[model samples]
Target: MRFADIVIPDTSATRGALEVATAYCSPALLNHSVRAYLWAAAYAGMNGIAFDAELLYVSSMLHDIGLVKEFDSHTVPFEEAGGHLAWVFAAGAGWPVERRVRASEVIVRHMWDKVDLAEDPEGHLLELSTALDISGRRPEDFPAGLRAEVLERYPRLGLGEEFIACFRDQAERKPDSLAATFVRGGVADRIRANALDG
Candidate 1:
């Protein structure tokens, strides 16, 4: 249950992000976030795409932090709110402005079903990884047994239902929020019918 003690990349930024994210996010979300990072990184490696692992680690781990009370917002989309929080963390951690900006972009854009790959390959990785996590979309893309290992290491623990509720809450609180848009557009239903239980 102690994730911070787990071994990860030795980079200071990723080391800090893992610690901060593990401490800040709920258990279910922590599991999901780490898996997202793993999936995204794995995809990058498989496809010969170059990426900053530190940025992906920070972006994916903190991507859902906006759903937490400390960063939740009525006016901003949860994605953007999380991006802003990630930006703050990155800045305080002394990330260069460009790097932090890319982190924010990667975090904020995951909500879109499609990402402009040329604009942000990192964002596209997030889209693919989150889509897989949230809905089991394109599960075949990940190598066999990878998902099993991730699940074993970090169980879902009702992450599906929890995220659905968070979206529902966001919908209720702000009809104009992205969650509300998804709800009104029937996307929420599709997301819930996804393979996961959380």
Candidate 2:
């Protein structure tokens, strides 16, 4: 789907924020972001998380606005980028600080499997959203240690052994790759934020 296809309820602030973000990044990623929003929404609904679908859509739509300002991993860590983006968009659009803060948090922690939700709500939500997006797919590119860690923490996630094997073998064979790990990490934190939030 085109980035333009991503719509948050009734042309809200998120729509304007996403328009600004699309001007900077590839539309392809925005498409993926839409998928992420769907995943998060479904997961939240199924698991009884008190999430607002429209708000989640809006947060996910503008989650990566930091890329618009050319913020890097080193200078603007992913955890902080979300909050920063919300603030920037809010400032640009004359939005309130509270709204900006919520959006910014979503962007900052969109990649958060390794984070603890008690400490970081935004990261947890992103993690949950990511996990739901790739629910049945195996991380065939994750390191052995990382795979073990995930399984240990979420044994009840019920991922099949075959899927785990596929991810482990592929990841081990293809060393020096960061795609699987980073992608998983992004969702991990979001999941925690969304699932573990009170």
Candidate 3:
């Protein structure tokens, strides 16, 4: 599946991930997932970063599954729960144990403040891409043409408002979770103020 110049990995694993994500996540969230992958892939292409597109694609699709009602976990952060789900999904796809672990790790690391590209290229790309999609960080890092094309292809669909609401719910229920920390740090304001929202 190609979007603009980005070639999304077309594999059983990628297809299954997309199906599961589309079945569970809201349209806004689903689009966010796809955009996350595109952003990461584009950045990697420009920066000469080597990555496993199938792994990245699968991880990107399932990275936010925990936010949805079907997969939300009461005992852990959404990212952690999502990671577990990704692990199962990867196993179902016949991924090796190491590859499965890598998928889980990439999903879990997307919420980190930073991921060292040298340590985990895919994790670093995902972290940067999710940050860009969610909080509109480093809009200048991507070319204007690429940004416009991606946005046009997958509109935000009010992700700013929906994501803030989801985080607020997570914060209220899991006060010790990263979602709580994000709410405490005024992520709502950042989402709303994102230049990309306009």
Candidate 4:
């Protein structure tokens, strides 16, 4: 069960996210998302983290769904509504209640100075995913508004500074444990072999 094979694309959240992900952000955002979910689930499984794979997978896909709809426009929201704009998009998509709620929770909590770590564990996962998405490269390439949030929420994972470091180290040294590689290769091959490209 490769990561890409399970990514449901027809949902409202996903449709909006794909547009936002491809246009507002880099392709790597989409790539890293698949990687993050795979890595997080694998790690959880190996260490007994008791995570819901489906929840993590879907939550990860939609965690940044807010980003797609709220970039650079002042009236775009992310303001007094407490990011209600993003949640509205997710909710309006007709996603299952649990998935919508979880996705909304992660999205709303992603902004630092806004995140309540103790109350939102999925938010922490979202934070960790955000940080690991760009840890090895120039910090400038990261979303300017998101850096503080990353720093604030990442440490809460209790993986320490070494958390992302460890994942990076594993990816560098042990590619099998590296989820992104498998997902990309798998997705590409699936598209090709299954004639999914249209």
TM-score rank order: 3, 1, 2, 4
| Residue pairs with backbone atoms closer than 3 Å in model 4 (clashes) | none
Q: How does residue 66 of candidate 4 score in lDDT?
A: 34
Q: Name the candidate that leads on TM-score.
A: 3
| Model 1 lDDT at residue 115 | 91
Q: Candidate 2 — worst ten consecutive residues by lDDT sum?
A: 189-198
How far out, in Å, is residue 143 in model 4?
A: 27
Residue 196 of model 4, lDDT score? 9
Q: How close is every model to the real structure, measured as TM-score?
A: 0.89, 0.53, 0.97, 0.44
lDDT for each residue of candidate 2 in 31-123, tens digit (9 for 90 to 100): 445545654544444445565454466667766543333642334343355566667766776757776666666655665545455654444
Cα lDDT tens digits for candidate 3, 17-55:
999999999999999999999999999988889999999
- Evaluate model 4: give its lDDT: 0.44
- For candidate 3, the TM-score is 0.97
Q: Which residue runs does candidate 2 get wrong by more than 4 Å?
A: 1-8, 67-74, 114-123, 132-198
TM-score, candidate number 4 = 0.44
Please write out the lDDT profile of model 4 over residues 62-171, one tens digit for every residue: 44433333342233223213235445555666666766666656655543333444666556555554444433222333343343433333222222232333233434
**Candidate 3 residue spans exceeding 4 A from truth:** 1-3
Off by over 4 Å in 1: 1-8, 196-198
| Higher-lDDT candidate of 2 and 3 | 3
Candidate 3 colliding pairs, count: 0
